[model samples]
Target: MTSTPRSPHLPLPAAALLLAVLLTACGNQPAVPDWQANAHGAAERATAADLAGNDRVARQEWARARAEVARTGRPELLARVELMRCAVRLASLEGGDCPAFAPLRQDATAQEQAYADYLGGRLAPEQAALLPAAQRAAATGAVAASAMAEMADPLSRLVAAGAAVQAGRATPAVLALASDTAAAQGWSRPLRAWLRLRAEQARAAGDAPLAAQLERQIAIVETAGQPAR
Candidate 1:
């Protein structure tokens, strides 16, 4: 939102009728789709609005992004877009099946489907081979927090940790790592979200003091990042 360099590591879902995939001229060949340009920041902008807890702006931006991706004429691109949404949600500590990816599954690439399974927490250890390298260890039930740290990109790291959480094999350390990662990135929305989640976990475990500490952390972030009313 503040335009402080949104990382462009991942590719985006394709847009309808807007095949802006750049091409290096090679005789008569078509231009290659610049996957990085197509993805990462665009749809993430939509979800980032949501992460900021702005419901109306989130809805508007999501619709706009979905409309843009609908023109890509590739189902896998759309499916991947949906995956981005689910990953962001997972990192935010929300729980649910990636319902949106189901419809696009019939047309998705095997790799995309495998990723869907990985994110859905239904992937088998053998299927880990099909996943992105950043996520392979997590899919195979490796130490999620450690694996998360191995990722150079902050978002990639969170996505891997989120997949581990979805897989139901995440340790308490996973959430802690997510919080630290968000804080280090100066992502207040996700920092607050992870802190609140940890606070809830502490409350359920009857650790009132720890819960209060976590709440204080959340308050600090929220106060500093207080959005314009």
Candidate 2:
């Protein structure tokens, strides 16, 4: 086969050079670290298992995620992984200090320290600016718990609800919003948790009927996946 002659201005390597330039332009996004990518995916799975209330599975997944992130030997990154786990657990109402991040705290950034405080329900309004975008408004108390219904991401809204609950700011409207978000996401475990709190709130408010209704809802969510008799 007769090959087309190369133009003097465009040598054989010119096509390859052009391809590299075009590829570079198309790949403007920075390359993600392999371990970071793997760790991120594992972290997501861990949070999912947590929301499903599968503690054992969540633990296993979190370990995998931590292992991946630990490859960097970076304490700040490790601390972030710990914080992510703690945040999910907090949202699930499984109260516990982020002990894992403590030793790493010295290496954590100012923003991370602020996040740790926020997760512990101690963040001040001024520190709210350091929190994740999803929780900022809630942290600042600029937005009512009722306004949680307006948050777009289900998981983010749930996390914000946890912050509100920790801060003793979870109102009836907040409970309702959290319950709805959990139910919509089919996160029955969190749904039950939020409903239980709502029931407690109802009883405290002397609304026995409302409390009873919430109790029934909890039961339904609990038995949703059981084998039929």
Candidate 3:
């Protein structure tokens, strides 16, 4: 028989080492979860589609957000939803065809007043003194006039009232009353911001013919004497 050609053979230890290296390489390779990765990719695609003016996709995103809010049952998230809804309504008003959101406006105003009252009662007399004179008078009147007013602190009451005003439930007269009181009591930056935002929202919602109208109203409020409630 012809001499058998010897097959090349590695030492056992070397072979084992090579096998371990191959196994390690395979183990180190990143494993992709195809379903999860695909889902993420699809989400990115959906976002892109939404940005490309796809109303359907945009609505789907909104719906998802709404569902999340519902599932979480967070009041802050609910408030955001309400705000977004209001914004959508305002934006839909093309050529002045938008429906009046009177009820929603009223609700907002109520909420603002409640917040103002709560804040007002919590403030110190010295702090209250920084508020506008008219506002002080209004707060006094609110304190004296309210029969069921269990609100002990003037500043807290004022804050709650301010919150109502900011919510758009309060008329300009009421807002000015609350604002004057807060200002005289030593208006905080937060209170001022609240008033400004309320005025801006009123203008944005087209409550008046133009933003100028809202500005004029605010100016009048800032300068004019307090009205009798």
* Highest-lDDT candidate: 2
Positional deviation of residue 101's Cα in model 1 after best superposition, in angstroms: 1.2
- How much is the lDDT of residue 146 in candidate 2? 52
Ranking of all predicted structures according to TM-score, beginning with the best and ending with the worst: 2, 1, 3
How far is 15's C-alpha from truth in model 2 (Å)?
A: 40
lDDT per residue (tens digit) for residues 1-229 in model 1: 1222221222322122121232233445554344534443456566667566666775676666566667667776677667667666666666536899899999876666777787678887677677666677666745657877777777666666667777777778988898898889776777887788788889999999999999989878877745766
Error of 2 at 28 (Å): 8.1
Ranking of candidates on lDDT, top first: 2, 1, 3
Residue pairs with clashing backbones, model 2 = none
Candidate 2's C-alpha runs over 4 A off are 1-31
The alpha-carbon RMSD values of the candidates against the true structure, listed in the order shown, are: 6.5, 12.1, 25.5
| Higher-lDDT candidate of 2 and 3 | 2
For candidate 3, write residues 1-229 as lDDT tens digits.
Answer: 2222211221111122111111211244554334323323333333333323345774675455445444544443333333332222221111111122232334333332222232224333444443333334434333332421334433334433443333334445544444454445443332344356556766767765545654564554455445855
TM-score of each predicted structure versus truth: 0.76, 0.83, 0.23
Model 1 worst lDDT window (10 residues): 12-21
lDDT of 2 by residue, 40-124 (tens): 5677677778888888988898899889878878887677778777777776676636788899999987777787777777787
